[model samples]
Target: MTTAIDDPRRTGYAAEVVANTLLDLARAEGRQLTQMQVHKLVFIAHGFTLALLGRPLMYNTVHAWKNGPVVRRLWQHWGERGTRPIDAPLPVSAGEPDVGSDAEAMEVIRSVWNAYGGMDGVELSRLTHTRGSPWSQVYGQSADLIPNEITREYYTGLARSA
Candidate 1:
């Protein structure tokens, strides 16, 4: 049976794969991304995927952290680097789905990079923290998880307006 990762109808790559894909994209363009930047990029890519592709990008749950939307696992993976640029890719464990191989997901990721990759962490934070953003809605409330339904809805509206 095809699992979510192997299913073509979904793009539930592990957060590590998603982060590493973003890092790889940055590296190819001769730049390194900070931990915070990676967090924000992954979140943005996920949002866009939901909007454009009508599917989730990664299986990871995004939390409305104090700063912005964050995949807790991805945060911990590179959080120790603080504001410094992450110079290396996180190792993807065996049996994980490959981000590069997923054409649809890669298209979404590359588009996100083209549109938002140049923005720094603070700018990305501002984008995600804007009024009515998914993070903004759940930030001060008791809820932490930025539900996919909410995310999909918010981004769908953005897509329509754009």
Candidate 2:
């Protein structure tokens, strides 16, 4: 009875497997997920995996909140005790220790990336400014420095080729 739908090797069947599994789980738990919710879950799960694997975790904590259940489950199952909270809010400020120099700012970036599940440098810069951090203030004062790390050149090239 190996119909196309039953053939796990096929892309369509593989997708069906995942879809059925999710639907079955949702039905069993009496939970429903919208398309947007599912997209957010996939995005955050990818980000979390990248982070744990030492890849550049490029997403925002708001995205993390969208995937809170997955993060909570991962933490509970694998993460160390006290490493993170079961229901933690995203960090809004650079607490306590002052970032004094570029070196310090880089460290802040790393910590923010780790804590917030990563954000684009521009977004991170904006968030720091929003929180009234000294680094953000200094960066805001400087008109020369480009906030985005991805670089205008790369974007320009892509746009030109397109």
Candidate 3:
């Protein structure tokens, strides 16, 4: 199986691009996202994409931060806890503003949202904080990027069992 690293469009998404879309998606669903929720959702969406599609939904790296997995670029936009609009080019390969129009991407995003959207930031944080989770494996490694392989494997197992 080809990994995102081997794909030409692996870098198709800018973190800001996904962050903006996710924030909008949350709002459209009447769920306003805090910085933490947005971060976890992105992580969850990425993991599902890797598990099911065998490709990254977005190009951004997930960082092991104090709370959980985070996209640094998204954090920069949201600040410490505030959710606000940050301009970014859409993630579509064609550079359109409708990044959510990609059916496969939307399917994963909505699936993740439905599974987690009702939860608070702290609950999502706990989910990532599980002892064997990718974030747990790198908890104190300040500069580590949570490996995609770990997330893919973990979520794949989850998908299979569910």
The whole-model lDDT of each prediction reads 0.88, 0.30, 0.74
lDDT per residue, candidate 2, 47-123, as tens digits?
A: 23333333222222221221121223223333443322223222223321222222422342343334533333234
> Could you arrange the candidates by lDDT from highest to lowest?
1, 3, 2
Q: What TM-score does prediction 3 earn?
A: 0.80
> Candidates sorted by TM-score, descending order?
1, 3, 2
Greater TM-score among 2 and 3 belongs to 3
Q: Regarding lDDT, does 1 or 3 come out ahead?
A: 1
The runs of at least 3 residues in candidate 3 whose Cα sits more than 4 Å from the true structure, single-residue gaps closed, are 1-12, 82-98
- Number of the top TM-score candidate: 1
Which one wins by TM-score: 1 or 2? 1
Q: Which candidate number maximizes lDDT?
A: 1
- In candidate 3, where is summed lDDT lowest over 10 consecutive residues? 84-93
Query: Candidate 1 — which residues are off by over 4 angstroms?
Result: 1-11
Q: Which ten residues in a row have the lowest lDDT in candidate 2?
A: 9-18
Q: Give the lDDT of residue 136 in candidate 1.
A: 88
